[model samples]
Target: MSSDSRRFVSQLAHNEPVSQVFLASDKQLRPNRNGNLYLQVDLSDRSGSVNTRMWNATDNDYKAFDNGDYVHVEGATQLFQGNMQLIATRIRKARPDELDEGDFITLQSADIEKMRTRLTEILEQIQSTPLTRLAKGFLKDDAFMDKFCRAPAGMKNHHAYQGGLLEHVLSLMELVLAVAPKYPQLSQDKLLMGAFLHDAAKTDELFYDRDIGYTDAGQLLGHMVIGVSMLDEKVRQIVQQDGQPFPERLLIELKHLIISHHGEYEYGSPKLPMTLEAIVLHLLDNLDAKVASFSQLMADCPNSESNWTQYFSQIGRKLFKPEKED
Candidate 1:
């Protein structure tokens, strides 16, 4: 897989020859105005994805590959809608020997082990006994930890890479630790716990083995609702294990934090942030996600000579990429 000759999807430049192995996705076939068949596909690697098309392709070519198949593509980069797109000339499914599984998974650049240790350190700072116990209930679950350490925060939006959920949570925790003191009325323990559990259900919401996609359960019930259920189940287990009463009021507040972290009803929260901790959790969570989204948008900007990226519908505006100072 590493011949020192492979070109990744991110390295593609305008009008250059591109020959590489990529995981194929979003396959569709349609005819031009002339009624000639053409293939439309998305080629992806760990770095990112690029939309591609093969003109004059036949149905056999379309049938030769599936959505998740690893394929070898020969194409040239072209500007489409002010962004880079690939105009493929040749495409074939890659043999098992040619496909490298590593090439297909996007990962966070942060050190996951260090992040995990930092998370543990932060959790230890929680002063409330019940909250501490509840947080530990999750930390002690090896099964959940394995998935949590690997799950992405989203499919395409902010922190949409392997280890993204952990990275995002850790980021929120760091911010809470820094700002919790400034606001004395906020419950320090609950605020930090909310940040950790806000997107914890994403471990199940997204299926990321090959490429990220929504699970049936995720489509049916979102992470916010699922997170409340998970928190309740954990509380029950804690009580059953210790034979001690877990505070019911504390549990309700924690559940509220998860359900209302989205901040508004339209954003999918069934309730708005009523508690100070919940309100703080919403703000910090949005801050981390929006910053991650903007950072990715800037990094993915194709034009090196230009400072402005193409208009992004998600951010609802084009971003300025300032030149680096030497």
Candidate 2:
């Protein structure tokens, strides 16, 4: 059945089997929680969102079930803890083709292909050899390219979802070009590679199945670490096949770009950006992510002169309607 955007939870489908169900994802996990416990779910459909919770004490969210698994939320809509959450009596895995495309994931309605065309145009303008080659190889893979283009750059924070990676990459590159000219201290080539290839590993690591699900690699190593491994492996392969000396120094510096892109070790970086490019990449990444998340907040929910939303941790601000300009 087609999930109407207007209907977040079908009062009619309350007792029926959960036909058009949106799945549970790791995106809902709160910071401090017990192992086997109930979870507050971000039940998303194109229309809007409803909070879902599994109240059954026997549930195993920390062990058996996981984030990003498709599940049938079968039960009735009931208020719990003063919130609108579906009180699920039973929950089971949802499979592919079990839902209409629109019901399962939230994506910008913009044309994905057009986004790709524009992304490729920016990529071709890159002058660094390894950066150019890396971008080309990733964009060439039919399956990977499709997922990368469509996947959110992140589950939250910044450019999140299909075309999100491309958009974020493009934004970082623009920032680098605009800023690099002023700082002769920064190697343009190194900065470009670090900026362009830093997140390329996310193309493979993150799988947007159901709702921005991580592949096994993502679950384990994360995009930054996996990307460095990917780069190292590819460099080894290139050096082995041909006796030509690969740019080892350039490659090492590029690795730093990925390692320090997260800005802090705990956040996932090996070190804060020592090189100018690394610093720039981190700052621009933060800027773009915060702006995108904030923009989404403004667009999805308006002030309406009625209500204001709680502070968004991603954007670190309360969501409010933008004032109209004459």
Candidate 3:
């Protein structure tokens, strides 16, 4: 919330006149050696996090709060045993949304229209008949296009912010288009479409909270299965209207791209990449997702850049290495 992060962090760092915050952690109540009820809150609101605690089981602050309310606590920073913590004196949830929602979440600064235009450009460049039509059907759906373009590549890790998936797709397309002119052995058309549509149902597939969370569809069907189902429906509609044959073999291959984009069965693929384009698409998709995750990690935690960088979990390994300061 535009609660001046620099000031809040500075105050906490300096142990100045107590700080106030929302976002209390949901941990079970426990008694300290002093026999006071202790509650710790993992307080964060887009700026950063602070661990805060309420002491005394019978205090007015404890009785006044039911233990999980978003409390505005007056507290000074203290090192409890070893880790950083706040010794809270007062506690209560603050007034609702003192700042706008926009201030509370991370977002891409890219032009949405330009990104949409870029996505359109990729669609225009496709020459494969079935893939081209599938791409167009998706791009033309107003509701799906809006959500897909605005949706993050993930709920976390790589492109976790709004328009993240588009950014990922755009990045992969750049590589695909560049490689097209050089590597004629690969089917550029299918590769590009595969990359663009690989995560299409992610628009409906992945769950996003303040960030994206896994929906039931996401957890159960996943984007791989969901994307295939969605495209299959669209293909049926297109055939119904025009009575066109969308190349059965190519349709299967496109389905393969969706089903196998995860690259392996355990990784979520029902089948490994069967066609040439599917293989390249899987690798390229993975390459883009990883590089982007590392890039964001470096952006978020510059201090940790020296030894190892911590990113949103999907990256698995901590990205290590700091940039040279100019």
Candidate 4:
């Protein structure tokens, strides 16, 4: 199919026919109640993703492609339990000639470079000598920087595309700059560094060459644990190179920010936000993630005729779409 005929996932409406190529992930072949097998997967473009099902599928169909491969899908979309899903008639590995790389990338190369430059400028603004050295240590690691820019902030929620991690961090850093000025007692440098480091280890935690998924380290330790370890490594490097002792209290506070940013135990925070800076970081992190996720849901909602989006089980409510002024 040509680009002109393509219907992106975000543009799909209820009861529309779908014939296009998409990046496939989270695939499974399972038996139904009657012992008939069906194929289940998520079909995605840069816009967003939709859950898809192919009935009466076989083992051969499941083996046709891997999780990250591009596939051609012949389907129709329908509203199922207030959410949009595709019912596929045919599915197969897409031919090389049928692919468009730009369709899958959320951010272009130029966008990522611009974000990286902004990130560097923000880090350079840090006034604390020890924290500044630590930030520079992470910046100078070419391998880590490359992965950090390419990694997604998450697998399915906010900023779940390549270069998304960088985008989220940069946005959060900007939030710190804006909010910190109003709260004069909070250290802007600490909040900025915390924002940058909070999700920095996601570069190592996730494998994002194609489909985003957890690495072995990510599954076992998660980003918070890995983040503390990463911070320690950079701190050690700074101390070894400068031939000086890093401040013990400052190091503990930085680690506290990382470990407590989740905000609660059920949310995976290892510790409560005891410090004022830690509390602010946790709230800011949550505010940014939720706003981004909600905004994406509004953009990707398929019910064009409705004033409200389809009920999202993830957030447990439907989102209202503001009427556009002419």
Candidate 5:
């Protein structure tokens, strides 16, 4: 594949001929109506993704490329069922050096440096001594900070792009600060600490240095448990440094916030949110994630002229995008 110039998936238009290389985010081999085998691949760039069809493909052709591999694709965009689809004429794996890694990885569009500063400011605003120490412990860890600043919040759910975890954390912190005043019973310290640590282990849960996927521990133990473990370790280190034990009650409560932030057991929380702070954290965390997911869906909606998006399996409803008049 020649690396002359590349067009992003977001820039594609209907019937536009394209000969570009993109990261193969996903792959599936399926049978059409006549029982003909075809390859379905999700091509992506730093911008967005598009589904492509490689018809009349054999098992060998399907085996040639795997998800997370960069592939040189020759295709023309077409409207399929009112969505943009790529009809691939040629597909083959591209060399690693053929494309820049930064070009394929989708990053949060926000100013990361500004977000980092805001993150520090929020951490500083935590009044609880133990909680601020714990937050700073994490912020000081270079390895953890690097991963936190780059890891996606999930593989596909809310904040799934690079630097998404930080964005999610900062947004939730900002939201909690805005709403906490009305609910005086809500501990600002606990809420802010919980917001920062809620998905902290997502740094370990997701492997996004290359492709966004789950780590072995992420699949087995998940982020909640991992986060509790992380908290335990950090608390131990803090106790070691300060020569005073981290308060047992505070430790227990913080861990509870992390594990129970999911709100419901079926939704992956090990325990229900029983405390006022926990309940508030659950509501705000869920609110930010759901709203971010909805925003992402709307932004990625293919039909620009349509006022509604396709059905979303997560929410079980298609979102209405009402047009604005001048």
Candidate 6:
């Protein structure tokens, strides 16, 4: 299909006929009540993803494509319990010539480069010598920097696209710069570093070549624990270069920022925010993610005429859409 004629997932409406190629992930084949197999998968593009189900699927059909493969689907959109999903009649692996790769890319190379430049500019604002050294260590690692610039901030929720991690960190750091001045007691340097490092390990935690998913380390240790270890590695490099020991208390505080940034135990934080910077980081992190999620929801809502979106069971309410000013 021509790019101009392509309809994105976000533009799909109820009862709409869909014939397009999408990057597929999270495929599962399971037996229904009648012992017939059904294929469940997520079809995604740069806009967003839609959960898809294809009934009466065979084992060969499931093996025809991998999680990261592009698939051509013939389906119809439907509302299932307040959510948009696709009921597919036919699905098969897409040929190389069938689709354009640009359709699946959310961030271009120029966008990533701009964000990388902004990230370096913000990290340069750190005044603490030890923190500066730690930040420099991370920046100098070309391999790590590549992944940091390319990894998604999440698998499905907010900022779930290539270069999303860098975008999120830059936005969070900007928020730190803005909010810290209002609260003079908070250390801007510490908070900025916390924002940079909070989700840094997600680069390693997620595998995002075509489809976003968790690595084995991410499933076993998670990004928070891995972040602490990453911080220690950078700190070790700094110590070896300067022959001066990094501050014990500062290292502990940085590690605490990563582990507690989730805020609550139910949210996967191992410890609650104890310090002023930690608490601020947690709150701001949540604020950024929620704003992004809500914004995406509004943009992706199918019923453009409705003032409120369909009720989302995850959040337990419909989101109100304010009318746009001309």
Most accurate candidate by TM-score:
6
Give TM per candidate: 0.91, 0.72, 0.74, 0.97, 0.88, 0.98
Error of 4 at 241 (Å): 1.7
What is residue 99's positional error in candidate 4, in angstroms? Answer: 0.9
State each model's CA lDDT, in order: 0.86, 0.65, 0.68, 0.92, 0.85, 0.93
Candidate 4 local lDDT, 1-326, one digit each (tens): 55566788888888999888999999999999999999999999888999999999999999999999999999899988877899999988999889988888889999999999999999999999988888889899999999999999999889999999999999999999999999989999999999999999999899888888899999999999999999998888888998988999999999999999999999989999999999999999999999999999999887778899988887889999989999
Clashing pairs in 3: 70-93, 71-92, 71-93, 72-92, 153-165, 207-212, 207-213, 208-212, 208-213
Candidate 1 CA-lDDT value: 0.86
lDDT by residue (1-326, candidate 1, tens digit) is 65366777667677888877888877889999999999999888877788899999899989988887889898899877777889999999888888777676555345787788899999998989998898899999999988999998997778877788999999999999899999888888889999999899999888876667788889999898889888889989999999889988888898899999999988889999999999999999999999998887787677767999898776689999888999
lDDT score of model 3? Answer: 0.68
Query: Residue 244's C-alpha lDDT in candidate 1?
Result: 84
For each of the candidates, give the backbone clash count: 0, 12, 9, 0, 0, 0
How far does residue 323 in candidate 6 sit from its true spot (Å)?
1.5
RMSD of each: 2.3, 5.5, 5.4, 1.2, 3.0, 1.0
lDDT of 1 at 155: 77
Candidate 3 residues 1-326, lDDT tens each? 45544234313442445645454443345689877677655654444445677676444444565433455667777644323456677777667764344443445355767878987987898887777777777777898888887787875557765677887888888888877678778888888887888888888877444434677878887887888888789888778766877888887888888889889877868898878888888888889887876665554453432556544355445566756679
Name the better of 3 and 6 by TM-score: 6
Q: Residue 297 error for model 5, in Å?
A: 1.3
Q: Which pairs clash in the backbone of model 4?
A: none
Pairs of colliding residues, candidate 6:
none
Per residue, candidate 6 scores C-alpha lDDT tens digits across 1-326 of: 55788999988899999998999999999999999999999999999999999999999889988999999999899988767899999889998888899999999999999999999999999999989988899999999999999999998779999999999999999999999999999999999999999999999899999999999999999999999999998998889998989999999999999999999999999999999999999999999999999899888888788999988777878999989899
Error of 4 at 171 (Å): 0.6
Sorted by lDDT (best first), the order is 6, 4, 1, 5, 3, 2
